[model samples]
Target: MKSTFLILSSKRYNYYFRRFSFDFQNKVIKTKNLFLFLTLLVLSVSVNAQQNQVQQDSTKTEKLDEVLVKAVRVDADSPITHSNVSKEQLAKRNLGQDIPILLNYLPSVVTTSDAGAGIGYTGIRVRGTDATRVNVTINGIPYNDPESQGTFWVNLGDFASSTESLQLQRGVGTSTNGSGAFGASLNLLTDAFSENASAEISNSFGSYNTRKHTIKLSTGLLNNHFEISGRFSKIDSDGYIDRAFTDLKSYFLQGIYKDENTLIKALTFGNYERTYQAWFGLTAEELQENRRQNPYTYENETDNYWQDHYQLHWNERLNSNWSTNLGLNYTKGKGYFEQYKPEESAADFANLIEEDSDVIVRRWLDNNFYVINANVVYKKNTLEVISGISYNTYSGDHFGEVIWGSDLAPNTNIRDRYYEGDATKNDFSVFSKATFKLLEKVTGFVDIQGRFVEYKTNGVNSDLVDFVTDANFNFFNPKVGFTYKPSSSNNYYLSYARANREPNRDDFKAGVTENETLNDIELGWRFYKNKVSVNTNLYYMFYQNQLVLTGELDDVGSPIRATSGKSYRLGLEIDANIQFSKVFNTSTNVALSSNKNQDFNATINGEVVDLGNTNISFSPNLVIGNSLNFNPLENLQVSFLSKYVGEQYMGNIDNEASKLERYFLNDLNINYEIKPNGIFKSIVLSGLVNNIFNKEYVSNGYFGSFDYDDTSSPTGTTTGYYSGYYPQATTNFLVGATLKF
Candidate 1:
């Protein structure tokens, strides 16, 4: 009877294979080889298993979903310095802020918001490294933008509500898909299918007229095989800065199918955001007068964008020793940021008119990205190996149009494009990772990857200059590490990794043609007892041709970068959690670092000056965070969180005028739950008070220098510095309630 059932299943699989082939041939031919290979392997394995008649275990499929991220995530005993955050922990702070703001208290992290509040356009930096160098993945699939290599949290407003878990690996921890991790890697797993049907409604209101509304539902397991879950969220904020407002809408939907040995999921998530411009931060004089002031006065100056994503994942448990995962993704993004230029030169706008004129123009980007990932895992008594291949392609169109202008040229329409450009990129990589027990209490790990990238662009840039580029690069990254567990409560580890990365679109435009490289070494210790856990690590990172920020902003508010010949960072990080008693606990982390640019030279005071071993820009030397929690009642909890960041420079030159002062901030959070036997299962009420002391501070800023002819100087020219600061809100409050049924 088992043989007969196998034969019938084979026939059904063949029919599905035919349909899959048809779709592959027309839609995703570029990645057909790996897809075909995996499919054939699955078929061959199934047919050969008929002779053995292995009984399927339905319980195994419930845990198969974890395989989606098994290839990229690390365990506590692994030779990696990392932290994991669960959905339950995030719920306490799931206000209208972006993901970066919610993760602000993590070890060695700094967060900034452009709207003077945490409601819109937030960014995160790890180990003093910017977001561009921090790789991000969703369920092991790449999430960073291909062209910019940056993660835009504003695009996924209220995404924390849909996340099941997230892990942050500091330093070049492992080899994964998409861009390389020069500083850190973050991967998130979406909500898992629930076992029981449920519905939830959450609403929150905060300062600055901020509010959020969310609706979520889960169909649970239907007939023990199928499940569906979804969420919709809307967020609005009248920001703390003048004229800075945000309106955002986002949704997430997923369908899952599970069986005795297989788990397949299809997901779609996206968001649309309209945010008023606040990137032009205030100068020192303006900040002293009114810290919430915005330099831009145009009423219509705003950024509007919409992005959509589709993902399909299949995980198969081919017995206990072998498994495979295949993932496919498609992302569509389109957007435009409108700007008002006063007295702009015609040459800059493609000679649309022969003279200077005030114009309102829009810059647009339309892009499509596709990815295919496949991996196979083998696990035995004391050995495990994972090998994977990933391929992605991106095509983007860039153009700009003048929507209104004081003067017009002949035969030009209102939406005539002033500049147009297009770009295409293809990235392919293959990697293999293995871990095995070498001794009674020692384990070893090795990871190797080869990556190839091809980038091409054509047409004119926004500066009305003919821009063209065709570049190709190949990189080899290798990592090795070992873990020693002396006892059940103590572990020690050491690791070394090497990574290489190419420049982004802006870097190419700035005449940067060299790739960057990093050599990182890490040593760590971990301890776990009945009521205490501690993790500490030391890291040394050396870089060549590193793309360091130049402390300048382009016309569109994007930061500019220039390559530094040599640089290094040395840091020590320690984090611990202590449960003093049943009702009280504490969590704290501290980071101390020294970041420097060796033999740095800059053009200062009309001469090239060597600033020997200067401090790296925006790299603070000391950062500390702490959380004190109390649970006096069964259903009530209160947490007091605090953070302190030391002073740092905004420019590599170490000029006194470019310094940003140190700041200490504190927040209070409270959560209470009511279990009712009425219509609702439970009601959760939460309140958050930020900057409880009403402290005024600035968290981020920019500085630059320029040389100009000066009659008073001894030389023919002199250099002057200019700076801008982004101020944080003094005091703010957010309160919310959630109903679950």
Candidate 2:
């Protein structure tokens, strides 16, 4: 295995599970349910006895100390519009689905799955902004690819099982690592150490031949100083669309050393995924005829990817008023997407081949990411200050090979290579943040950051042309805010922030591009009275040279975007939670927004037409989600979840023919837990029925126009539009169980 470091600390658990392997060419499958059952049963008996014999260690009662991640996380008094999902909240919905699906109900969030059932290739849009504009980090380490500026969730299968907490900050809330947060930022923290030794087994089965199995174990503190924990999971699912299936496996391991004044930690986690492609959605007419149909018909048309992460962290408390943290991180990622192209390609293949032939090709990407991050903090009676810096680099190679072909030269090898290219990016940033108490009930905040980005790429393009592009960008982001708290239960805040984002890899390929800028303003209030809690925020974001979707798709089905002159998004979001009674509780969120592109122009039929004040593509005007929970029995719970999305257009032109209709969806969930004497500590059973109403809906699509009348004159020529739709599944069910000891 190739990695940044080799340090295996859990000798006791090393014999239990072997290290992971990425080889899948000759994959084998074997069942060991019987052995798992008996092993867990025996461990249950021993764990119970161990639990009863262990005494309460004084280390467990020591004062809670802050972790190194606080340097990157948003503070309670940061005057930012954000939300937090605790471990308890995540556990309720962590059954084999992507993390985006679990956060679908959050304000201004929209989720879509390529497999149409939330198992393979999922996507998320927040406040009308796509995932590429969102910055994501895990335990203060940047997770977004520097070149693509995108996060591939499939590479981290079943990550929700290891996540202890998640926080989302909207509208470029604060300064952070990696790419700029043009729309929002999300941070995830893995599970904290357990004070007692424990073991868990979980299994799930659902509609469409879907199943998931997981095992987790922990070793309590040894010598009151060190602890170890690990988890392994496997998930398989036959998707709603034809041939859209997923088989995934992942693992997580951590070793920690903690004391009253210092903490050190090392971690390793990653996943391997093999899934059939479902990127080619159906046409609108085909969607009506057969909503479950998939256009891709080739066997072994799949995507294979694997990612591994390594991190070393150290934190020290110099004194009551000073603290510092240092972290080193590395990630190794490799993947390929295979495709089958039909015959008649000799002349079109840049004359690389002598004769027409049908061929199977694979595009591969192998990359390495390295980073060093450090931060220092100072706090006093009425003021706090933090200073941080980070440097990270990404190097990747892209290549393609012809694996099989109908016609070949006598000595031609199937592994013949073709197009090859590589890209490198270096990013560095420094930031300072401060908070001061202006009065007893009023506080002020300020943050400033300076960043430098360098991008370089050179290689042979698909057209057999030698291409090279080198770019450099410098950006300065500033933020200021104020918060007023008249009482402990009521609070009000207002903030303004400015951010800049550089062009990504795809953007460079299309043409020469410039950096984009955003100016955002946010105002929010929070109130809590008795059994009710409410939060509301109003935001206005203005953009310059923004990249907006133009309803066109590339060869691989990714949306095509063009630089718009100007754009803006204004929205209001509200979230509320209420406990109606001892047995009933409810939570709801609503988002209303107006997104527009000003003075957009396009060339059609040799004529330039100015489309004045058109709606931004794929940005809906309204979105609502609600959840109702009931606990009728001592250990039984039920929940109803609902979502509604308003009509929206698929293009910046806002043509009525390219509109996507509104949709309403509902889901039902139930969970029951059992507590018995002796060996077993707890047993949990859970189930989910999604889209209970069987509503037929299209969540995503594309539209474009072409000159139908090929007349030389611009006056008489006409244009026609075409569209493709991605329809979602009607109804499905998933049932699961968990045993802990």
> What lDDT tens digits, residue by residue, belong to model 1 across residues 1-741?
544753564464444434332121223433475455345434443443334333543222226777888878887899988999999999999988889889999999998899978988888889999999899999888999988999999999899999999999999988889999989999999998788999999999999999999999999999999999999999999999988999999999999999888999999999999999998898999999999888888898999999999999999999877889999999999999999998888888887754778899999999999999888876655556677888898999999999988987777789999999999988887766766665668887777677778888999999888889988887889898999999999999999999999999999999998999999999999999999999999999999998988778888888888998899999999999999999999999999999999999998778888989988888899999999999999999999999999998888999998899999999999999999999899999999999999999988888998889998887889999999989988899999999999
Candidate 1 C-alpha error for residue 324, in Å: 1.0
lDDT of 2 by residue, 356-431 (tens): 6887888889999999988776554445566777788899998877787788656667767678888888887766
Evaluated at residue 473, the lDDT of candidate 2 is 87
Per-model root-mean-square deviation over C-alphas: 7.2, 13.3
Please give the RMSD of candidate 1 to the true structure: 7.2
| Candidate 2 wrong stretches, greater than 4 Å | 1-66, 347-350, 409-411, 712-717
Model 1, poorest ten-residue lDDT window? 17-26
- Report every candidate's CA lDDT: 0.88, 0.81
Off by over 4 Å in 1: 1-62
lDDT of 2: 0.81
